[model samples]
Target: MGCVSRRTQCAPRDTRFPRSQLLQELARYTWPGNVRELRNIVERLLLLTGDAIDAATVRQVLPGRRPSTSGEAGSGTLANRVATFERDVVLQELAAHGHRVTETARALGLERSHLYKKCQQLGIDLKTERTQP
Candidate 1:
């Protein structure tokens, strides 16, 4: 049921992003719908943006949500912090490789299947992600 199984051709390889800044901006948003909403937003951004998706674009697309503060209550919970870090790492790597599973796996020193499972666990939709370019 994932995006990978449905696409006929490979995704384009020219996508570019201001990786760290964008990731920081995204981390600041408190996603009300959690992973699904995040995935949808990522898909939309990839589809709509011309060359890169910046903090300004993200701010324009998702207004009204406040950026998270490090001092906020419960922000230090170990489980939450770990999960957030894991998601960020996976997403950054995926973006770095243009969401190509094989390339990403090689970069991460993981098997393609293991990377896919990891992405699923991290709530990333590889299919939608791979279509970015």
Candidate 2:
């Protein structure tokens, strides 16, 4: 019932918030902000709390979806287009490698650790193409 400023209170705390209350707060929020904003918020929270976050973290960090690149004069922005292309490529390579991270990294000419981080950043599900036994 106090001031519900997500910028301040939702900045992450050692104290855990109740799941129900957090869900309600998230529903009431109008977070038109995109994935970038969510990423920044999550990063800040991670640094602040030094702990793992869960679904309830959604309340503390707003839900965001990147805007679509539709009906633009060209491809919205060069940087965004490049990122999309790169993500697609990584996903393809991952699929081709049967979701084998080490093999995918080698094929992409990347270090395994670097590929892991890149896949995380691109929001690619690393287990998407698991090989059959």
Candidate 3:
């Protein structure tokens, strides 16, 4: 067997698709479901698309999703904005993994303890806060 990086192992194998361009478009998306969402999209594309998976196909499949922009709707310092984004990502990941710290951390490529520290810094009370659907 050939050695494959974790990211490459996770992607679907479809030779007909413009893999690089598809990857670029996927990189632009803010996957709310994180790795799970990425896996689902790749699987869907493999099963649904024909000759090539283009940017238009990706957009059509992922409705209402837009590329992440630096200028969000808020008046805050750069640090504050970064923190807010981090907090949101953590919350979403936690919810996606049913608030399982280890799973969330692994999915995010972070250590479990580091994830806890980040959650604390973001004022996310995992014990008290319910996961959003």
lDDT of each: 0.64, 0.57, 0.66
Candidate 2 residue runs with Cα over 4 Å from true position: 1-73, 128-133
Q: Please, what are the lDDT tens digits per residue for candidate 2 over residues 37-86?
A: 54565455444333333444444345332233345534657887677757
Tell me the deviation in Å of residue 53 in model 3.
14
Which ranking of candidates, highest lDDT first? 3, 1, 2
- The runs of at least 3 residues in candidate 3 whose Cα sits more than 4 Å from the true structure, single-residue gaps closed, are 1-72, 130-133
Total clashing pairs for each candidate: 0, 0, 0
Model 1, 9-36: lDDT tens digits are 1234565667676667767887777566
Model 1 vs truth, CA RMSD? 14.8
Query: Residues 34-117, candidate 3, lDDT per residue (tens digit)?
Result: 566776666666544433456765764563562343465556788987897677668766776789999888766789999989
Considering every candidate listed, which one attains the maximal lDDT? 3
Reference-based TM-score, model 1? 0.43
